[model samples]
Structure formats: C-alpha cells, structure tokens
Target: MRGNFITLEGGEGAGKSTQAGLLAAWLREQGTEVVETREPGGTPGADAIRALLLEDDVPLTATAEAHLFAAARADHVENLIRPALAEGKWVICDRFIDSTLAYQGAAGKMGVDTVRAINASAIGDTWPDLTLLLRTDGDTGTRRAIARDGAEIDRFTNREFAFHRAVAEAFDEFAATEPDRFAVIDGRNDIETVAQEIRSIVTERLK
Candidate 1:
C-alpha cells in the first residue's frame, strides 16, 4: 500500500508538533506504520539549510529565504519523506509546503502562487494528501509560543504580531480556497482535546 502523507500546519505555538506526535502514536497503536518527521529539517542536508535559514543573523531577501526553504524541502522529500511513503509507512510531518506558502508566500510578500510554483519543482508530486490546519487566535498562539520557547524564539516567531496575524490569515484563506485538502481544527483547547480531533480526522480520511 502506498502510504498516506499528512501535514500539520498552523501559526506558531498551535501545538502542531505535539499533535503530530500524538497522531503518529495513535496510528501505530492501530497497527499502522508511521514515519514522524518535521520541516525544514527532516533530512541532514535539509537540517543544515534549516540552520542557515533560521539561525543565521544575516538578513536574506524574502525571495532568497523562499528559495532556501524550497531547497531544504527538496532534500527532505527526496531523502526521507518520499522514501518512507514508498515503503508503505504513513508520514506525519509537523510542517511542510503550506508553511512556506503561509510564511514566505503570503506573509513574506512573495505571493502564494509564486511560492507554489517554486516549490513544485522541488518536491514534484509529494504534496500532502491531508493538511490539518490548527486554528488559534494570534494573541493566544504568541503567548503559548513565548511560554514554550522562553526568551529564545526562532526568526519567524520573533516577527511582529501583525506579521503573525498575516500568516494566520493566509492559512485561513488557503484552507478556505482548498477545503478538500485542508481540515481546520480549533487549537486553543487542551492538547488531549486537540489530539483527539486530529486523530479522528485522520481516521476518517484513512477510511
């Protein structure tokens, strides 16, 4: 069986990472094999690019950053995600192309169409079969992120509130436009509640 690919997307602190882990575990409990991973650092090469894109102090142009993300994703899909799926292992990714679309395309001012075009060549037909868009208010998400990461925040997380809001709005617009591909979930609830919702969605999709 060709394995399913699922991507979790949301604003910072939406608990995508946690939910992804929970979903993968639940899938395993049902005797399904799962490959749990994340972006933009899923593979070794991609991890290097992730550090450059996230940690380097030098400011990269929006277009440059988008290209970096594409490059990292290219490596990740080729080296890890694609192989895992080919072997009949469901792949649960914390973030994926949708993040690039929301952050680099919409919020980064590059345009979603352009970012999508750029990434098309990178990952080819590796788009997720399902994307769970975790929804949470900007203030609450930001507070959660700050609390989780403490004083140290990633480059994207350090952006102004307005930027984060734009990212959230972009995710919403994308979900609305592609309702079949996206399942939006309330992310403000406790972790167990959110996890249950995600698991249910994934289970239904599998059926």
Candidate 2:
C-alpha cells in the first residue's frame, strides 16, 4: 500500500512546524511509519538551496526566487520524499508546492499560473493527498513570528505587513478553490486544541 502524503501550509508563524511534528508523532503511535520533513531542505542539495533562498543577503528577482523554490522542490521530491513514500512511509511535510503558489504566484509578481507551470515538471504526480491550511490573521502571525525569531528574521519573514496579508489572502483563496485537497484550520487557538483538531481531521481522512 502506498503511504499517505500530508502537507502543512500557512503564512509565517502559523505553527505549521509544530503541527507537522505533532501529526507525525500521532501517526507513528498509530503504527504508521512517518517521515517528518520540511520543504526546500529535505535533502543535502535541497538544504543548500534552502539556505540560499532564506538568507537575508541573497538578492533574487521574483521570477528567479520562484524558480529556485521549484528547483529545490524537484530535488527534494526526487531524492527523499518519493523513496520514503514508496516504502509506505507517511510523509508529513511542513510546506510544499502550495507555498510557492501562494507566496510567489499569488502574492508575488509572478502570478499563480506562471508559478504552477514552473512547478509542473518538478512535482508531477507527487502532490499532497491532503494539505492542512492553517489560517491566522497576518498581524497575529507576524507577532508570533517576531517573538520566535527576534532579530534573526529571514528574508521572507522581513517582508512588509501588506505583503504578508496578501500571502494570507492568497492561501485562503487557494483553499477555497481546492476544498477536496485542503482542510482549513483556525490557528489562533491554543496549541493543544489546534493539534486535536488536526488529529481528528487526519484520523477521519486516513480511514
């Protein structure tokens, strides 16, 4: 049997990493073999690319940035993700193609269709079986991110409030369009409550 693929997505500080960890742990306790990973850095090559993409000093155009992300995803999918899934491991990812679509396609100057086209060859049929879209207000998310990262914010995290709001809106629009693929979660609640909500959704879907 093929293992399930689940991706967690949202703007910065939406607690995707936390939920991904919790989900993986719960799935493991259920006797599922879980592979917990994050985008842009799952493998060695991808990790180097991730560093370039996130560094504050790396200057890249919107189109260039989007392509970089696609390249990283390609390497990550080919190297780590595909093999794990082939072995029947539940791969829980912190982010995936949807992040590129939201950040570069919808929020950035590249547009959604263009970003999708760039990623088509890379992702192919490896899209997530379920994407947990964690929703939080931009301001609140930013506050959380700032509290977590402090002065060490990355390039994406340093973007203006308006830009972050646009990213959040784009995620909402994408989830609205792909209801079958996405499960929206209110991320403003306590961590335990959010984890329970996600666990319930995952349990229902895995059945």
Candidate 3:
C-alpha cells in the first residue's frame, strides 16, 4: 500500500511542532509506522545543513539562503521521507514548501515566483495529500513562541511582528488558492481542540 503523506504548515508561533508531536503519538497508539520529519532538517547530514539555514549571523543573501534550504529539503525528501513512505508509513512533516513561500516569498518580499520555482524543483510535485495550516494571530503567536521557546530563538523565530503578520497572511492566501489540498485551523484553541480539528480533517479526507 502506498503510504499517506501529511504535511503541517503555519506561521512561526502557530503550534505546528506541538501538534505534530501530538498527532504522531496518537497515530502510534493506533499501531501505525509513522515517520515524523520537518524541513531544514530530518536526517543526520540534512540536520547539519539545517543548522546553517536556521542560524543567525550567516549573512547569506535571500536567494542564496533559499537555495540552500531547498537543497536541504531535497536531500531530506530523497534520503528519509520517500523511503519511509515506500515502507507504507505515515510521513508527518512539520513544515514543507508553504513555509518557503510564506517566509521568503511573502514575508521577505523575495517574490512568490522564485520561491515556487525552487520549491517545485526541490519537492517536484510530490506534495502531501493533506496540509494542515495552523492559524493564529501575530500577537498571540509571538507570545506563545516567547513563552514556550525560552531564549533559544532561531533566525526565523526571531522576526519582527510585521514579518510574522506577512508570513501568516501569505499562508492564509496560499491555502485559499489551493482549497483542495489545505485546511486552515485555529491555533489559538487548546491542544485537544486543535488536535480534534486536525483529526477531523484527516479522518474525513482519508475515510
């Protein structure tokens, strides 16, 4: 059986990581061989590249930085995600191409065309069957991030309020354009509520 691919997406403080973990655990309770991964890192070597991507003081140009991220994603896709899927496991990705589009394309103002081209080249239409976009307000997201992450904020996590707003708006627009593949869920809700929303989407679609 071909495996199911589910990619979770959202802005910085949208609670995607938390939800991903929760969903993975829930699936394991049902006896599924779920492989949870995330962009900018997954495998060993890919994780090394991820450090460069998320680290501050790198000083790379926007386009160059985007290229590196895409390369890392490509590597992760080939070495980790695909193999896991072929083994009939659920591949739950924390973030995928939408992140690039929102962060670099919309928030960084690097143009969607470029971001899409790179994303296409990297992921090559091998998109997730479903994408859960966790939606949250900028202020709420910022507070959540500050509260949860303590002092170790990555480069992307350390953006200004306007930048997060742009990211959230971009994701919202992207989901709107691709209604068939996306589901926008409120991240402000409690964990079980958010998980229920996500569970409903998956059960509905996969059923």
Candidate 4:
C-alpha cells in the first residue's frame, strides 16, 4: 500500500510546525512509520536551497524565488520524501504545494495557475491525501508571526499586513476549491488544543 501523506499548510504563525510534530509522534505511537519533513529542506541539497530562500538580506524576484523553491522540492521528493513514502511510512510535511500558491502566487499576486503548473512539473499532480490548513485571522497571524519570529523578520514577512492578509484569504479560497483534500482548523487556540485537533484529524483520516 502507498504511504499516507499528510501535509499542514497555513499562513505564518498558524502553529503548523507544532501540530505536525504532534501528529508525527501520535502516528508513531500507533506503530506507523512517520517521517516528518518540511518544504524547502527535507534533504541535504534541499536544505542548502532552503538557506538561500529564507535569508532576509538577499533580494530575489518572485519568479526566481518560486523557481528555487520548486527546485528544492524536486530534489527533496526525489531523494528523500518519495523513498520513505514508498516504504509505507507516513509522510508529514509542515508545508507543501499549497504554500507556494499562497505565498508566491496568490498572495504575491503571481497567479495560482502558473504556480500550479510549475509545481506540477516538480512534484507530480497528485494532491496530498490530507492537507490541514491552520486558519487564523490575519491580524492575529501577524502579531503571532512577529512574536514567533518577528525579531528576525524577512522581506517576505516584513511586507505590509495587506500581504499576509492576502495570503490568508487565498488559503481560504484554496480550501474551498478542494474541500475533500483540505481541512481547516482554528489556530488561535493554544498549542495543546491545536495538537489535540491535529491528533484527532490524523487518527480519523488515517486510522
């Protein structure tokens, strides 16, 4: 049987990382082989790409950034993610293709279809079996993100609130389009609540 792929996606400060970790632990407890990874750095080569992509000093065009992210994902999938999944392990990703659509395309105003085409060329057309989109108000998201990593904000994060708001709105629209593949969880709650929700979703979906 093919491994189940569960991806968590959302705007900054949505608590996706914590939830992903919690889900991984729970899956392991259930005797599932879980491989937890994040976009842009799931493998050695990809981690190098991730460094360049996340640096605040470097100025890159949206297209250039998208290209690098896609490249990293291609290498990550080919070298690390795919093999682990083929072994029937649960693949838990902190962020996946939906992030590209939200950050670089929809919120960046680059056009979602274009980003989809680029991503499809990299990671194939199949969607993840489940995508948890952590939903939080943009205002709250901004404050949380700033608190979470605001001390070292990047060009992307330092952009106007309108940008992050756009990203959140885009996520909503994206989830609406593919209700089956997407699940929206309220993220304003505490970490334990978010983790419990994640644990429940994974248990229900993959159990």
Which structure among the candidates has the greatest lDDT? 2
lDDT of 1 by residue, 1-207 (tens): 789999999998999988998898889999999999999988999999988888747688889989999999999999899999999999999999999999989999999999999999899999899999999977679778988844457788888888889899999999999998999999998999999888888878874
Clashes of 1: 0
Predictions: Cα RMSD each: 1.2, 1.1, 1.3, 1.5
Lowest lDDT sum, 10 consecutive residues, model 1, at 149-158
The full ranking of all candidates by lDDT, starting with the best, is 2, 1, 4, 3
TM-score of model 2 vs. true structure = 0.97
Looking at model 3, the pairs that clash are none
**Residue-by-residue lDDT tens digits, candidate 2, 37-80:** 99878999899999999998888888988999999999999998
Residue lDDT tens for model 4, 1-207: 779988998887788888888888878888888999998799999999988988988988888888888999999888877888888888999998889888899887789998888888688844589999999977788778889743557666677888889989999999999988898899998889888887887677767
Question: Which candidate number has the best TM-score?
Answer: 2
lDDT of 3 by residue, 1-207 (tens): 868899999876788988999888888887888999988799887799888887877766668777877888888888888888888999999998888888888888899888888877677757888999999977678767877836458787787889888888898898899999999999989989999888889888863
Candidates in order, TM-scores: namely 0.96, 0.97, 0.95, 0.95
Better of 1 and 4 by TM-score: 1
- In model 3, where do residues sit more than 4 Å from their true spots? 149-151
Give per-residue lDDT, candidate 4, residue 162. Answer: 89
